[model samples]
Target: MPKLITGGVAVVLCAVIVVHLGLGAAGVGVLDVLSFVAGNGDENTRNVLWGSRIPRTLAGLVVGIALGVSGALIQGATRNPLAAPDTLGVNAGAYFAVAALAFAGVNAGVFGNGGVAFLGGLAAVALVYLLTVGGVLTPGRVLLAGATVSLIGMAGAEFLQILDEHQTRGLFFWGNGSLMQTGLDRPLVVGAVVLAGAALAPLLARSLDLLSLGDETAQAMGVQVNRVRPMALSLAVVLAAAAVTVAGPIGFVGLIAPVAVRLLGIHGHSLLIPLAGLTAATLVLAADAAAQVALPPSAGYGELPVGIVTALIGGPIFIVLARRVITGDADRGAAVVVAQARKSRFVTALVIGCGLLAVAAVVGLRVGDMDISWSDLASVVTGSGQEMANAVVSFRLPRILVAAGAGACLAIAGVAVQSVVRNPLAEPGLMGITGGASAAAMLVILVIPSAPVAVLPVAATAGGVLAMVIIVLIARQLDPTRVVLIGLGMAATTMALVNVMVVGAQMNITAALTWLAGSTYARDLSTLGWLLLPAVVAVMLIVGGRAVNMLALGDDLPRSLGLALGRTRMLVLCGGALLAAGTAAAVGTVGFVGLVAPHLARRIVGTATHRLMPMAAVLGAVLVVVADTVGRSVLAPTEIPVGIVTALLGTPYLVWLLRAK
Candidate 1:
């Protein structure tokens, strides 16, 4: 059965590749490609097949195998099925290295860039591993550390991109996970890495099998757990680096391939590892093929990057899998209950202090562009300052409202997701919800420029919901922490898609830049109306619900309390989806607010309870407003988007929270 499944997959993959080779922006067919390969074809067919198709196919195959093997190695070493190359910060490191090189006007040869990328990948893995290491390596700690590194790396990359537009344009296509073959060296380098990984991997298979039995058991079984682990991780890093060198961090194949193999009942190290490699190769090839043929002819003026296609497909699959894991079929008793603990007096004071900070945020808003005083503010609100009223009502008021609403919604969504997924780091931004929304919005805008403004929000909402559904389903077979890891995979894929769109379509990249930085104030009455209704509905549904309260206890106890697990879970997910999508549609993918607000709320309330949902919402709104206000005023007449400010502020707080815990 397993052989049949693998064989079937192989056949499909081959057919897909053939189709890809035959089809292009210029029309061709299988017969033409075959004739070209045999050197008996027309000039046009020969040029198309040999120059474009063959190289692209080879690049995809090589990169795919590299990523697949890397993912398998990481999962094996960590004993976490969700582990992948990106989990160790390899992608971020490679991206940053390339960005730096490009910014410096250093046009390295393909091999030279590959070498640098490999070194960067290795360095990132080493740093993350060193930071998280104790006597034993914990997958959870590694994931958190990697996330921190990725954030820092991304911020640096963005700064560089802003500083140099020429470099930005050059790196953009590569960043989107392009499989456009530069030369034969790409495949040769990737192939060498895969071969190396294959040779070294079997040496650790016995150790890996023991490691999967848990650290204590592995040690008891005479495995040198620590010694073997570093070696395994090193191998994974090398493989991932090689892949990134060629394909620029095409994500999720590493994640999807091994898991797919496991699902096919190929769990043994010997069988599963090879199967994962093949599956990964096939997936990338198929995606590349689809990018060539499936897209509209007009869409691919230049070659469409394969990464985007994979991300669009992979993100939904990951989300469904996540949801399934969280809502287990067998009721494991009532969701594990968090005690309804009240805040102490000191904590209460802190809450009041934060509230005061929020008031100051309102004042901060008036300090930008044409400054307005408290007197002017009062007059505008009371309709005394007619001229100021024009500015305040039309400009400042809408900006503030959008910022506040978006922040609150995102924060609440983050908190709900983190609680359900049982991970401190889980947020819509981190989990691919933002990416999914962004991609859908980009696609809508690109394909239908004349579409109504309302269509963008609708598209974003649909994409977010689709992603959520896939994640929820995938989570069924794994622990909540694993769900977060899978979500990261999805997030990377979605980001790749966005990059592809930005590069491939050559759209107004300034718009993408603005949205990515999390600017507020795009909201008009129309946007407000669309967002407000959903936000209100979500708040109403979750605010006083017993089921939501029980959910904080964890999944096991809710069932014991007579809550229908599936139904309750679905409701909560739907509510979260609405909250995230509405906020993204309104404010263009704000960051850090969702992550920061709930953590602060939990600090104030001293527990996670659905009753505190209102408080969290309010706090989220306040935090976002303050961040946006700061963003506007920090540079006076010029404005940095609210998203940048929140990320800068929120990331430190997240680190502190994690460290404290």
Candidate 2:
């Protein structure tokens, strides 16, 4: 059966490659390609074949093979079906390394990027491995750790892109994994490396088979488990790096390829390796062909990235995998695992936290290139400040308010979400609310450029509500793992749709990028005014905190206590959506604040929902205020986005929390 399936996949792959090579804007047929190859066609046919279509086809093939084989190695070594280069941060690491080189004023060619990408992938996977070493290396733990590292890598890359928008246009196109090659040089170079890596991979086939028997058994059987593990992983990284160099970090090919082969019941590394390569190649070719025809190169909408197409397809597949029986501790333990504080103590902590937020806001006002002293700050309030200081304060205050308000809103949103889901990891980003708001906001920006500023927040809010409804409906069982995975699928779908809009509309992506990165760079008081609704929602949430607290007792207990469980959940969910929407409207989906702030507040103030709600809001405010301040002052004229700053700050704490016993 496996052999038959593999043979079928091979035939389909060939058919796809052939069809793709002949179809394009030029309308060249298979016969034309054959004639050009046979030296009997005209110059136009020759130019189309040899110059564009042939090189593109070859690049996709090489990329597919590389990603598939690498994914197989990662999953086999990790003994985790969810393991893939993209999921494990290897692809993001590679893309960031290349983007960093470009951002640093280096035009390092394809080879340079490949080398750096290899190192970056190695480093990222090493961190993930280290995080899991003391544990039993469960699939859930490894996947979450990979997700954390991926977030950090992506944030770093986005920071670099924000630094030099003009010089990085090529990087952006490449970052999205476009396969618009003009010549064969890149494919040839990357293909040589991929072939070399593939040839070397089978040497560890015997050891890999043994390792799958578990590390202790493999070690007892005279396999140098440590050495063999690293060797296999290194080979995988090398292949992924080569693929990224050729196709700009195309995601999910590595993931889907191996998973697809495994579903066909292939397990031996010797067989799985080659079959996975063929499967991935076929998937990539099919995706590229679909992308070409869906928008059509002749339609003038520009070619959609094959990466987007693959993501749109792979997300549902991932959701299915997540829902199936798998190995790991999927149960997220304890809603709040911290020492309980007294009412007075909770008040003290909330006061202290709010005080810190205020201090951070003041520092933000005074700490830019032109610093404003306390006297200047007072004088500005009194209308007697120096003109320069007054100007600086005027420029800074609105963004500071927006940051604080958005942070508080997000933190409160997290608290509300975690209450109902009973999972500490539940946040707006994980629920697809952020992605939905982003997609809707981008649509408004591109489709109605003449619309008033007020329209964005309303559109964003409506989108958030829509996404929340979808997540709620689909996650009827409300299993934390299933809900999160469903949300991930929805998020990926929305992001893919957004990418299509960006490429199709040829919109000015600068503002969109800033919003996506969650920047407060040029936000004004009007944006702050829009945050009032979220603030009001936060207050309502806090007032109803006791009902939320009942959720911790599990479903039956809440019902027994006379709480309208369904109605309360519905109301809280709506409140959560409103908070996220308001913040997205104000500052563009600032990530991690919602995830991190609530946890920190729980640690400091205990699990009483009423106390947790306000404490989390204060902490959230402090976090975004500090993040905004650091983002603006760290690089002076070149600002880092606040969203990136939050991710960099929060991911380590999240990793540690996951690693904790």
Name the candidate that leads on lDDT: 2
Q: Which candidate is the best by TM-score?
A: 2
Tens-place lDDT per residue, model 1, 1-661, is 8779778877877776777687666677887876766878898887777677777788877788788877888889877654677656787777778777767878886667777877777777876665564422444455666776677556656656544554455455566578877566667766776777876777777888888898899999999988998888878877777787787767668878999988888787776777788789889887877776655455645656776777676665655544433322123321212233457554464477568656855675467767777777777767777685457556776677767667768877876666556555667877767777877888898899999988888898888777777677766543555566566657766676776677667665555766776777555555577677558755665564666667656556778888786776666666676678767777876776667776666666654455345566777777878877776776666566677667777767655544442
For model 2 the local lDDT of residue 150 reads: 78
User: Candidate 2: misplaced stretches above 4 Å?
Assistant: 1-3, 23-31, 37-39, 107-109, 202-227, 265-268, 296-300, 325-344, 386-388, 447-453
Worst 10 residues of 1 by lDDT: 329-338
Clashing pairs in model 2, backbone N/Cα/C closer than 3 A = none
lDDT of 1: 0.70
The local lDDT score (0 to 100) that residue 483 gets in candidate 1 is: 61
Q: For model 2, what is the C-alpha lDDT against the true structure?
A: 0.82
Angstrom error at residue 509, model 1: 3.9
Error of 2 at 195 (Å): 1.5
Residue-wise C-alpha lDDT for candidate 2, range 148-247, written one tens digit per residue: 6777787788777778778555666677787789799999989999988888777887888888999999999999988988888899999998988888
